[model samples]
Target: MEGVSFPPLSRFAVCCGTHGNEMTGVYMYRHLQKQKVENITVTTILSNPRAVDACKRYIDIDLNRCFTNALLCTAITDSSPYELRRAQEIDAEVGPKGSDEAVDLLCDLHNTTSNMGLCVMYNSSDCVAMHIFKHLKSKITSVPVRAICSDEPISEGYALDSVGKHGLSLEVGPQPNGVVRADNFNVITEAFNHIIEWLQQFNSGATFEGGVEDVYKMTEKVDYPRDLNTNEITAAVHPQLQDNDFKLLRTGDPIFLSFDGETLRHKGRELYPFFVNECAYYEKKVAFILGEKVTVAFPSISVTKN
Candidate 1:
């Protein structure tokens, strides 16, 4: 996907430290905002300054989760959650959800505590997104371009990326919360730079394109085993699956181990599981997200984001 850059292309780079403790995005945004790229114009934002300052995930609500159209249209006031008003401010800055000021592409930076080394998430089956991941997979090490498709039928407004035209959220992890790993930080920087260079090339009349890619699109969100009476999580992620993100699991594979001696097994078809036992998702009851790998053939077939 390497090509000579010519003219500039305008885009937006928003690093929402919505979960402020996820420092990969925060630190990378700080670095990239300082160094400017030519021809490829960008509007970078540190989405949650206060949360980052407190060294916590969020103040009231997750800022990234406050972007649904209904929420965006709401009037901000002193009574509202900090994230609610902050979302409104950010929507105005880079995007008022489809206005002229809205960036052509939105790059939301994120990180996870799971062993998910590098995951690229997009709204739908966007060919442009596929092409970007294809190029990135070939370049990044330790992990390939594992893509997550957040296909929303209606405006969920639960993420910062949902407010833009064409956008992708870059999640890099296995690092803990509230701290920066130089190695992880370096990978994040490299991935973003690669995308920027690729975008410049594409806008400059180069087709940094790919034909097809095998991406694991999220099919269902699996919650941890909970005690029905007390609603407390009763089981934990199986030892076999720990740090085994992106590995294909077949029918009857161990997925969870109960507090007692029983083991919970997967009974469905072969599937790929990532974000296995993510710490932040514990509150949401998401033990892990179950996904299926599908071939995304580009150019030949037109796949819309809707």
Candidate 2:
């Protein structure tokens, strides 16, 4: 494939606090609000301010899940949920999504209780996002940088970043909710610094050489073992699987350890696992997500000269 040129990414948004307890983003939003970059119209947003004030993930529903077109276009009513209303308000600010008025790029900051390092997540095979991931992989050496493609269509994307023309989420962790670890915080700081640098270079017409890179495409989610009658979790992630995000899991490998001391093994073909035992996923009923690792090829990209 030939190199691709995209319009300069002028209007950019860095959003945080989509999940209120993810303190890294909550604080990063405040940190970034003080900084500025030349030529880029930076819009810093503290998404879900009420959730941040209360230090809860959300009040009525997950704000991150409220961005689907069906939900965003729904009419506001006297009893609309707080997050749905907030989503609309945010869409009005940075989005009104899938329109030309949306920001050129949006990076949503998030933290996880799982041990995944610095992971960049996107909904599609966007060249600009791929280039940004490639640049971050080169610049940020403190932690492993990886990319995950959820493969959802933009209009159906449920996250805040989906509001932009080009969007990705910077998710880092092993940090506990409501607590900020200096190490994790520094990783996010360095990442944003590098992202800003990449943007500046791209806007200046720098042609980034692209090649094949490994990306994990999310396949399916695994839920915790539960009692049929009680509807309560009956087992925990096996010690072997705990904190082992991105490890390949083979059929017959231990996946869960029951309270009664019996071990449960994996039952399917081999695949990589991520978000293993996420703290927030307890409510979502996801023990972890499995993904298929595949190499993706991208073309060299540069800002189209006006």
Candidate 3:
């Protein structure tokens, strides 16, 4: 892991508990807000606070998926669904959508039931994001950083981190929903502190020159085996592939297994699998994402490919 000539950050935004039951981020955010740091002002949001209190994933819909432009349009007129309205409110507070002017950066924190480790997920090819990603990877050399850039035409991007400025979502897991593991908490807290200190260093006129060798870029999303008639998931992640996030999946790799003991193997080209069997993804129909490993250099035009 190397460093980048990161720029100074002034105002920052963080959305915690976006999924409600992911308590690691919620607890971490609660811990961070009470402390004071210099050179950067922050706007902290406890997204889906009601859901957090209820110990549920969401009060209505997943806030992470409800922040798109097309959905936000409905959020304005409908105002009925809790998450839809909450998305609008969040946009006004820390997004480019409404009244609350977005700041210099944003970091939406999350946890998963799958073994995602610590991933810095982002959509765009913004240089600032690349710089930050480079810096975070340098801090935690073992953790993987992921880029989920949109390759197809989308009405708007999904996820809260996309709403604000040049930042990303940090997802750490293998912990169940509503449960906070000390190991996960310590890792997230360390990453949070690293971001703070990195920003402080940047503001104090620190410059760096670093580059990335390879990165996993999510190219497609795979759905779990579902019943066509009822549209219900009918299979589970194959035992052979469980907890195999960030691993290579070949054409004949086991992907899922039916309850009745039937196994389904992937018959596609080579790909890297991540977010396998994530609990929150059940509703979204996503079992995992198929990523393409590409040679890339940070802060270069090569990474700007969408």
Model 1, C-alpha of 70: deviation from truth (Å) = 0.8
RMSD of each: 4.3, 1.0, 4.5
User: How do all models score by TM-score?
Assistant: 0.90, 0.98, 0.87
What are the clashing pairs of model 2? 91-96
Model 2 per-residue lDDT tens digits across residues 1-306:
799998889899999999999999999888987886788898989998999999998999999999998899899998999999999999999987999999999999999999999999986568788888888898888888999987777777888989999999999998899999988899999988888888898888788997898999989999999999998999999999999999999999999999999999999999999999999899989999999999989899988887
* Candidate 1 deviant stretches above 4 angstroms: 1-8, 153-157, 300-306
Candidate scoring better on lDDT of 1 and 3 = 1
How do these models rank on TM-score, best leading? Answer: 2, 1, 3
Judge candidate 3 at residue 293 and give its lDDT. 78
Candidates sorted on lDDT, descending:
2, 1, 3
TM-score of 1: 0.90
Q: Write the per-residue lDDT of candidate 1 for residues 1-306, one digit (tens) a residue.
A: 222222234575555576788898788767876887877667778888889999888899888788888889998888999989989988888787766567767778887888888888886645566667777888887565588776674255468876666677888888888878987888878887888877776665664544667777888888988899999989999998878888998899999999996899998888898999888899888999888988766652222222
Q: Rate the local accuracy (lDDT) of all candidates.
A: 0.77, 0.91, 0.76
Backbone clashes counted, model 1: 4
Residue 162, candidate 2: alpha-carbon lDDT? 90
Residue clash pairs of candidate 1: 8-39, 67-157, 68-157, 91-95
lDDT for 229 (candidate 2) = 100
lDDT of 3 by residue, 1-306 (tens): 444343356778878988888999789778987879787897889989899999898997778888778877772555487988888898878776422466767889888888878877775455566666677777875556555444322235677777765667888988999899998888888887788887776677666454664567887889988899998888889988899987899999999999888999999999998888888877778999889877666542112111
